[model samples]
Target: MHSHPDDKSLRDLLREQWTVAPVRNPGFRAEVWARIEAARRTPATWGAWLRLHLLGVSMVAAASIVFAGAGGGLLAGARDRHEREQLVQRYLISIDPHQSSAGEGAP
Candidate 1:
C-alpha cells in the first residue's frame, strides 16, 4: 500500500473515465456502408491495377526484355558466323581456281 499525494486524484480521474459513456454517431454505420458501395461501383483504373499487380507485371516485363535481348544476340551471332564462313570459302576459292570450278559443278 503505497500512498502518494496525486494518487487520490488519479483514482478519481480513472473512476470518472470508467463511468463516462461513449458517444455514438447514428450515421456512422450508414456512412461506412455507403462508402463500401461507392467503392464497389467505381471501376478500377489502370494505375490502380498496376499498383496491385506491380510485382508480377514487372517480372513478366523483365523476362520479356531478357528473352528479346537473348534472341537478338543469337540472331547476330548466327549472322556473323555465316559471314565468316562465306569469307573463308571465298578466300579458298580465290586461291584455288580448280576448287571454285568443282564447287560450281556441285549442288
Candidate 2:
C-alpha cells in the first residue's frame, strides 16, 4: 500500500479532512499585482511585430509598386517581343508549311 509521511494508507486517508497552507509568502500576491500594473503601464506594442513580421512583405510590396511606376517600360519590351515572335511564326507557317526552320528533310 502506498503511504504518505504520516504512514496513512490512501484508503484510510480518504475518510479524513486536512488543511492546506498558503502556497506562497504573504507579499507574493502584492508583488505579482505590482508586476501586472507595471506591465499594464507599458504594454507590449505592435511596433516589434510590424518590424519583424510585416516589414519584409511591406518592403517587397513597396518595391514592386515603385518598379512598376518607374520601370514599366520593361513590360512593353516583353510585349513587343511576344508580338514579334507571333509574327514570325505566322510568316513561317505561310511560306513554308512543311519545311522545318532547321532545314530537316520531311518523310
Which candidate comes out best when scored by TM-score? 1
Q: Per-candidate TM vs. native?
A: 0.52, 0.30
> Which pairs clash in model 1?
none
Model 1 C-alpha RMSD to native: 12.7
Compose the digit string of candidate 2's lDDT tens values, residues 2-101. Answer: 4566755754666565557677688988999999998776636777556656878798999999988777788888898878777776677688885346
Question: For residues 3-46, what per-residue lDDT tens digits would candidate 1 score against the true structure?
Answer: 78779887897887877668999999999999999899665898
Model 1 / residue 94 / CA error / Å: 1.0
How many clashes in each structure? 0, 0
Residue 70's lDDT in candidate 1: 100
lDDT of 2 at 38: 84
Following a full C-alpha superposition, what root-mean-square deviation does model 2 have from the true structure?
Answer: 9.2
| Candidate 2 Cα deviation (angstroms), residue 6 | 51
